[model samples]
Target: MSEAKGHPPVFAIHLTSSATDGTRVLAVGAEGPLSADLTDEVAELCRTADDPGRAGAVQVLPRPLRTPARVVVVGVGAADPAGWRAAGAAAVRAARSDEKLQVVVPPQTSPEAVRALAEGAWLAGYRYRDAPDGPRSAEVDLITDDAGHAPALDRARALAQAVWWARDLTNAPASIKNPPWFADQVVAEAATRPGLTVTVRGPDELAAEGFGGILAVGGGSATPPRLVELSWRPDGATRHVVLVGKGVTFDTGGISIKPRESMKLMRKDMGGAAAVLGATFAAADLGLPVRITTLAPLAENAVSGSAFRPGDVITHYDGTTSESTNSDAEGRLVLADALGYAVARLDPDVVVDVATLTGANAVALGKGMAALYSHDDDLAAALTAAGDAAGERMWRLPLPEDYLEYLHSDIADRHSSPARGAASVVAALYLREFLGDRVDRWAHLDMSAPSWADASDGDLTKGATGWGVRTLVAWLGALGR
Candidate 1:
């Protein structure tokens, strides 16, 4: 866990035909001086994984002079940056078993490629070695150039590592990461970092503060709901940005119970919370001059006697009443309150909220892409540009002025969720009511699809993907635009 301090190290390895002189190079292609150390490390990595097979595409090498240092022969999948990063992440994991080793990646990679390598390595190397732990890989080595701006690279490392921390929390099992625990984690982080102040608003404070939306959604859970606020404004910072996240630790769909299979991955429903925290830490480590306050409405969406029902109408702190269309759509409810609080209290120039808010987003963006909703054209464009730079996919979805009409509920101020078909779009429109005319400057990301990985890509692992932090950090850096 001590390795959590910085980004993982990676080496640039050279592949050679005659590397068979002694070392079992898991050489995937031509070896050269640049990648020598990396090839040796990859061999060691493969050996450590302890698989009896070493398959390289169209390459033959003499077998076993010894344990074979885990021959993870990777194929030249594509000329794309993603492939190289996947290779980098794969190398880190495959070489991981040995106590602290370095895996080499492509040397002539682009800036984005280097970032992808670091992102994937740190992400893949993450292990929540803290909780009642057993045997695990102690640390990982990521090699980078000593030249250029070392300070900036160090900052990059910190940002990537912070993303790692956030991912670790998101990937943690629900048993260890409920509402109170999450609040404590945030409190601890805020306390440890300089230039940060945190506040935890429990059920009583929520009720007193008129956070009816968060209260109603989490009221049924065994654990009470909490509203967590983390503020950072170093000395003379200029811009202030507010980020809100839906922190439903384990959603049972409440009175609107989902099928068992549907509820299995509910722990990851808090992916938005993870993103906010990750972005905050990364911004701090990157030393962004902008002031930031992150709002994570921590709650466990459970099924209990106190849980709000489908027909129930609850009034939020913002004085907006919403009829429960489906208790499962509770994320948006909690987020609505958080967003309102952020706007009213922080009064930042811009606000953004992230959440695993809908299955409909998945239908529209599929598994690897996230859906971006924004009334502000500039905000949407910024986010899209950042996504392009960061290699995270976020396609913009319009929050049409007319779509707001669909949220009409004769019995209440609005419906918790609109009817099916255009669910994700309507959900965005629903949030617009709380944002009001200021919506012209705000953005919301429906990360339901990419919140959790269905498969591993080059640098992205097969679990909590740390999906939005890079794009978010990039977007925040481009704020004035």
Candidate 2:
């Protein structure tokens, strides 16, 4: 955890294949480097090596150029973010088990490539490593010649650190990351920064203020529920943006319990809250000018006698009634309350909510992409552009005004979920009811797919991918421009 300070060192890259100390990594694209740049020995090795550069390709040799003890050449086809990230991560795997290494930045490397390289190397090296004897790797160094790249490198490292922070929180066990603990962490973070204000509301206050969704779902657990509101307002900032995250510390599906197999990874159900919180921290770290507020509705959906039941009707913060036809559809319930509170109280110029709400999102976009649904085209475009720049791919899904009919309820205003297909779209539609014309610049990110990964790829580790944070931070940074 102490390694969270900064990025591993990277040095300025040179074209010559001279040997150096420790492990040295070289970047090779589809079109291999110029023949003149390689030493005679290294050039001969390249000829003997299988296909110099293809996507995700790597070739390792023992002192080919006679400088370093070992050398690795990684393929980065097309030099896109994914390719660069893979190359950086591949370098981590190719290095000595416990040695510090240097990575050679390719000539004419784009800013995005730099970010991908830093993010991949740093994230791949992350470990819970709380114990003294846990496996650890030396710092990674990126070689860069231009002093102009320093600022951008610093920003990239900060963003990667924030992602790592979120990943740690998401990977934590539910026993230690309950609602109160989560609130305390949020408060502790806010205390460290100026111009930031944090407010926590407990179960009693939530009940008094009519946050029925949070209360009902949290009632089943002894840990209770909490609402954390964080605001950062710098002087002269006129535009305000609100980010709402669904903080279900652990989800058991309440009265409509999930199967044993499906409940195993429920600890990551709060990935949305962690992601937005990470973005807030990143924005503060970068000193962005736009005002930002993050709302986290913290709760645990457990099974108990008092657990809310299907077919129960609850009144939300916006005075809208929703019937819980399926208790498993609880993420939207908490998010609805936060969305209403943000629009009614903060009146932000833009609103974006993140949640691991539905499996349908994974069914549609798979685990590598997040589903983005929005009513505002401009807002959607901006977010997509920001996501592209940050290497977080978000695919837009239609809200389908016609799909609103699926949420119809016989006894209440709407149903928590639809009975049949289009579950992801229906969930987004359910949240839209809370906006009620007060907010137009809004986007809902269903992070069920990209929130966690089964295996490590690029800079993302095997668990808690830290999905939405980078995209939101990038978007917030681009707000004024």
Candidate 3:
């Protein structure tokens, strides 16, 4: 037990043999035998726990040895980076109090595994409630024999904090996170930051600037719509990247309306915007050398007399007209406007758009990964590699040229909703039209599946997953300093 009741826990990393003798928490993987330092009694108690070697399994008992007060053994089934993260996260959650915690770094743990363990613990520590709770308990320390891994752990902490920021934004209630409010947060971020500039355009400006997609979808809500642009350029940066996010704060399927059950989680429709915000902030904080521009078209898809209806025609920012065939297909409309604005205004070396755009994406890729569509193979490969490195999985789905016809509408340039078959790819194709031929290296991440997790696991809680933030940050970091 911790000596103090409310004091934040202290985290330290130590070699298994060097763990301090005191009342403490010892986190270890179940794959191996107990450390030789542990007394025979503690080892016997651990072996008594059935199937302790299974992933996510846990066994906690009073320390029979002269060391810590309690020993918590967590199962890192495969002893991989992901397994280590899950083990660390589960151990932190299972621990009863904020006490001095020491995690024994597995002898075979790679630097990446060390980072994962740190990130897992860091993320599990976050709790979002409206009440003014006091600060969280002490920090977690990683005990390792090698001192060289400290810098990597520091970097991981920063990245995990960025993810936490995104999760907070995404988890915010839609009533409090409307378009104007979301824009306000960007303005506030820019006000405090040094290298970032934020520009927000309201409904009047959006209409004047020909952002009909945003205006049309936002017309039903009293909150209006906004196009938020954030630009960050560090000194001596050569490469440029533009990121666009669909910020539908809440979606009710407009006039089409959604089933009651389907509408419950619509507040997370702004997950893409949250991700880009987090990634941009992370890049700025880390002092990455690549110039980055983030665009979020913020709106609410509500139902009212003014709501855009089926068969309505909308001219997007790039002068491409679209027919609103299904009001539920609103994400692509807002994203199309931002994507066009990025290509037309920024002229970056590459463009990427993230959106919780389609239910079909959940069906195509399941909940484990996002559906990735790219215009250029090199950019696609680079993003895939980045996602792999960041532990966010992406599956490349082709933007079949043949699917373009599904978007054709007799009254307008195209239809917002295409045929239901291959729906996710069709949505991506619709966005590609707005990019035009001028942009070569472009990619779309349909993040519906990965944007929110159904239950808490590993580094994620049961709300917004903040999935793309890490992947985007990793991609930018890999672009070189």
Candidate 4:
């Protein structure tokens, strides 16, 4: 409808047309003559182009054109469907360069598949390389079969920006992302958006509220701790969604100190928190008319004599006692406390807590996907769909009723971890206990696998991915007008 902030909507967001000037399409194909639609779109695009080269390399291009927006033909080479998706992402990046032209969508496949590629393109096209002014921005035109494309494109744009926000919040060094500092970032970021009310609960306030789990997690760190909440409510909002994110700035495994390599990526331990915060940024950005409240439980589980020991017993905010079986499991503690607080305070219609919670999840799902565990089948399916559309993979794991026995403790209400293997299952079951009997719609996401990349992949950039944000955002987007 309008340009981001400035520019007179310089490019019309359009589907692939034969014209390439003010309108252009991102094209890809097998090494053969262009398809009829592809050829026509390229021809039209070339007319708008001053240089045929910038027209956009995709399926193919015209030799010359009237205008200067050169053609860009993205080479699909010989890849299957997934290859096309990657090629589309590459096309978006290529088009963004050297000019401010609108790149059109050329979805030759299913709408969802094309949207997946577009999501990837929007994601890969991001350049967080900070300019003194900030990162450069580009305009994208989605070639769609449907008439109503602007709203969908806008939603995708919001989701992409939110992913970047999640990555930045995760990528910022531990020195820059401490608990209080993180809370401040949340306040400043959330305050800028309309209809968002920000609240910060300090350590004293947490203690007063019986948030022993959070207090225990953050007590060792010099940075103190906080619970930052961002809420958006329209009149008579139909759904209440509460998201609890683990905000451990860094994790040292506390008394159960991890190896040097394990601690290396600890700075990203709060990747889950960043995702929710980033999603909050998107929510505020899009002004989605849903009652979304995000709780970021901030902490740094450092190692000092003051650090909670492995043998220590913790009294949680819900008045449940937990015997710490392994100090590395501290993420669940902070998240448990946050979840407890969220369920108690908001009593939301649906509650979700995202965290880089367990290593077993990584072992189960690998780095490409996160494990999604929920009591509600509908919520699980919704999250799975969101993950696919957003290009984040999530596998729904069963929260078996029998698995509850592992978390039981002889001395306390629960043991911090299960006695045997399959730690991921045990971890999810442990969290289920914290939600208590009333909340039936709760789900836990173990983001350990997808949040951090071994390196950059097809569409993912190196470091923090802000994994669950898009899915959560998309699910929320589906809820309201």
- The ten-residue window of minimal lDDT in model 1 covers 52-61
Query: Please, what are the lDDT tens digits per residue for candidate 3 over residues 230-336?
Result: 99999999998989998999999999999999999999999999899889988887888999999999999999999999999999999989998789899999998
| Model 4 worst lDDT window (10 residues) | 8-17
Off by over 4 Å in 1: 1-84, 94-96, 103-116, 130-139, 142-149
Off by over 4 Å in 2: 1-38, 64-67, 80-82, 106-113, 129-138
lDDT of each: 0.72, 0.80, 0.80, 0.72
Question: How well does model 1 score by local distance difference test?
Answer: 0.72
How well is each residue in 99-129 modelled by candidate 2, as lDDT tens digits? 5667777556777778777776777777754
lDDT tens digits, residues 1-481, model 1?
1223343322223232223468544443433423566455556554554331222121212224332222345433443445544544565655535434454444454565555555555666566545646533235554554344355446557767766767778888999888999999888876777777888999999999899988998899788999988887866777788898889999888888889999888888998998888888878767677889999998888888888988789888788899987888899889889887776777788888889889888898899888998877877888889887776889888666776677778999988776656898888888877886567778889998888876655556667877788888888777634
lDDT of 3 at 334: 91
What lDDT, from 0 to 1, does candidate 3 have? 0.80
Candidate 1 global TM-score: 0.82
Task: Tell me each candidate's RMSD, in Å, in order.
Answer: 6.7, 5.8, 5.3, 7.3
